[model samples]
Target: MDLPTTLAEKIAALSDGPGCYIYKDAAGIEIYVGKAKNLRRRVASYFQARDGHPAKTLRLVQETVDLQVIATDSEVEALLLENVLIKELQPRFNIKLKDDKTYPLLAITREAFPRVFCTRDRDQPEVDFFGPFGSAKELYRAYHFLMRVFRFRVCDLDLREDDPGRRSFKPCLNFHIKRCSAPCTTRVSQADYGEDIRALRAFIGGRNKGTVVSSLRERMKRAAGELRFEDAARCRDQIQAIDRLKERGRLRDYDEPAAPTIDIHAGMERLQAHLGLAAPPRVIEGFDIAHLQGTHVVASLVQFVSGVPNKDAYRRFKIRGEAGDGDPGNDDFAAMR
Candidate 1:
């Protein structure tokens, strides 16, 4: 199936990088939105084979007359951007998530002390919904994990900052167990609780993630310095949880078949041919840099042997030089060098 000349040119010029792609119909309406780790390869795959693709995919390709791509710094960013676009655009070929009964959403209630919980009821008012997550179980797990870290209220109590009744109200077991800050009992101030809620929102929304992690690290260090071992431990655990969240965004459990096993030697031969190498390359190394709002920049390198990750060969480096000074001092090119 040959693509239109213009579309083919666009495909040829696509970056071999992580991004989201949008397929537009003849009327210039978006019909489908998808993410890919390699923009060129993934987009090209759609045009290359029509034999094994589902009927819906074939139809999507047929209707698509234009293409658009938004590149991201990483694959995780691409995944998050794809989710936001799918929700906002409601593309024709994308799965419908408007039915509240079908998928679960993580809602943060609009109250003095906002309650974070998972719900299938989208009709609820005065709430911010994070997802129509692919799995209710995974959503619930994330909800629990977030509660553990943020310690936001999960109760139905009408908490007001100046509510006199809160002074006398007994806190629940969650407060005693340190799972909640007991905003209902006025044990935690509205301002501090609000800050936690804001951090939670930013973390889930995948914005300022580096800042969040860095803030947690500082809190952990301060707690340790003050001999507050429990607080320090809690902060440490929160940091680890945030790292896991970064690694697996939203826990999207797709009901797709498992990927077939790779043939290492065949893959190596293909890789050699593709790169015009004299012999099949056995080792490949990849590098990425991370920083907190351009400070504390660090780089990581990972090795792949025979098309498989060699975790033992992974290394991390603390970037040094004049680039690490001043506010917002991140220099990707200098760091790479």
Candidate 2:
């Protein structure tokens, strides 16, 4: 590929609209994928020798093999297509976005007596999961608080009730530490455990929304009025649970948007007049390339669920092909297969 003599001349030649543009290197390998509101102007930016562009742009101008474009109705559509193309081809140059941390997740199994605990993977099949929690310690503190307040199980469920090897009278260490409700002791009935699990879900969801706190105080007053010291002790624990919720709220505010219907996938409307075609596919995968002085070019994929970035489903690729001379070609359309 050879450099086109004049940069402004190319801009004067482009038609304005939504589309994908390709930039190639000297050997004619595409190294970058980009979208444009106006083809000519967008393409010309790279060729502006005096524009003080970055090294990537400079390389783009020097080795750009050819120009290609695909006109679309809108920039939004162009953005959608841009993401698709870059991901498939993994063009040498593109911005990268990353999310790479595992936090404690709450998982509740589908059973007569469900268990609640922290997990990291969001892909558990039979359990409900919440969170890509920010920090393990914060999550653990929250986990332990929930366990103490909720009295749910905190030990392995694999041991059989009649397993001969199992100690008939021995309780797990966690039970001794007050982390477990000592369910293994047979002292906790299934019905009672079920009640605890329900309360826990409500607490984690932050419902009762301070109602728990108010209820506990009222109960403590009633118990004290009746001179029932044992009932008052129970109410005190509820008060502490309220305090735990307050502290956790300060870190991860549970002010989530109204939860989406798990059934409906976004962008899957059955009919739309604008498309003049079938409903657009709801699932979208966005691709991006990021480079640092052409030294490290990274490709990224962002998976969207209902037009929202589900950060848990993201991946990044390190690019090495055609990145050396700094001019990574940007043919996103070809990458779109």
Candidate 3:
């Protein structure tokens, strides 16, 4: 089949980047909206030899008189844009997401001490949604994970800053269990809660992971300097959680199979051989230290017996030596020692 000159030229000029593409008919009505990590290759596939193409795909190609592309910084952005466009345009080819219920979004309500939850309702006013995630299971998994990390309020209580009852209201079990920050009470101010929401937004929007982690570390250091050990610990925990989330995302991206179970005795023999030890080491110990700018320095020691961790032998120590009179310095080696 001969290609239209204009279509061919547009395809030739397409950027080799992540983006969403829209296919339109003669009437300039959008028939399809699709996302691609490589816009050029993906869009070109539609115009290739049509012999093996599906009936629906062939129809889509035949009817596509014109097309448009919107490039994005990354594939995640492209996916998000594709979802929004599909919902707004109701493109004929986007059958999978024609109904909003097909994919769920994580929404953050726009209010004092905003609420974060998973929903299929995109039309909710004053709400910002993060995703049309791959599946309900994945969406809920992320939702729960984020809730655990952020500790935003899960309750539907209409919390207001000026409400007289807010200060007197009793916090729920979520607060006691450290699941919710208890914004319903006066403990968490609107401004402080807003910061948490903003951080959550940046995280879910796929912003630079390093930047978020760096910001949290700085907060941890500041809190530690102010002698707010609890606040510093919270920041430290959030940073660790973000690191775990990033690692999880990387594993998911690779879609790699789980590693086979380790052979404890064989592994111990190999380790002993590698180290040229006199015997296959029956006991091994590892030490690591955590600190916020040298303040609140803590070290953990884990023991392994025959290549398996011995949970009962684990110990945690507070590095009192590093906590000098008024000033502290990051001396990880000393703390470990």
**Backbone clash count for every predicted candidate, in the order shown:** 0, 12, 0
On lDDT, who's better, 1 or 2? 1
Candidate 1 per-residue lDDT over residues 1-337, each given as its tens digit:
6677888899999998877899998889998988887899999999886888999889988888899998765555565567678888898787665444668787889898898866777889999987776557655555555666678766555679999977766665556655677787656679757867887887666446688778878877887898877667766877776676544533342211223312233456767999999998877899998889887888899886555455668899888755555433477877887
Which has the greatest lDDT? 1
lDDT, model 1: 0.72
Candidate 3 total steric clashes: 0
TM-score leaderboard ranking: 1, 3, 2
TM-score of 2: 0.36
- Across residues 251-304, which tens digit of lDDT does each residue of candidate 2 receive? 233222233311122123422344565655445698986666654566889775
Q: Lowest-scoring 10 consecutive residues by lDDT in candidate 1?
A: 253-262
- lDDT winner, 2 or 3: 3
- Candidate 1's displacement at residue 15, Å, is 11
Per residue, candidate 3 scores C-alpha lDDT tens digits across 1-337 of: 6777888889999988777899999899999988787899999998898888999999999999888998865554455567667767888887766654657887888888787776777889998876676556545554556665677875556679999877766665556656567777777678767766777776665434566678778878987998877767777877877666423432124221223212233355667899999998877899988888668877899886555445668899877764444323487777654
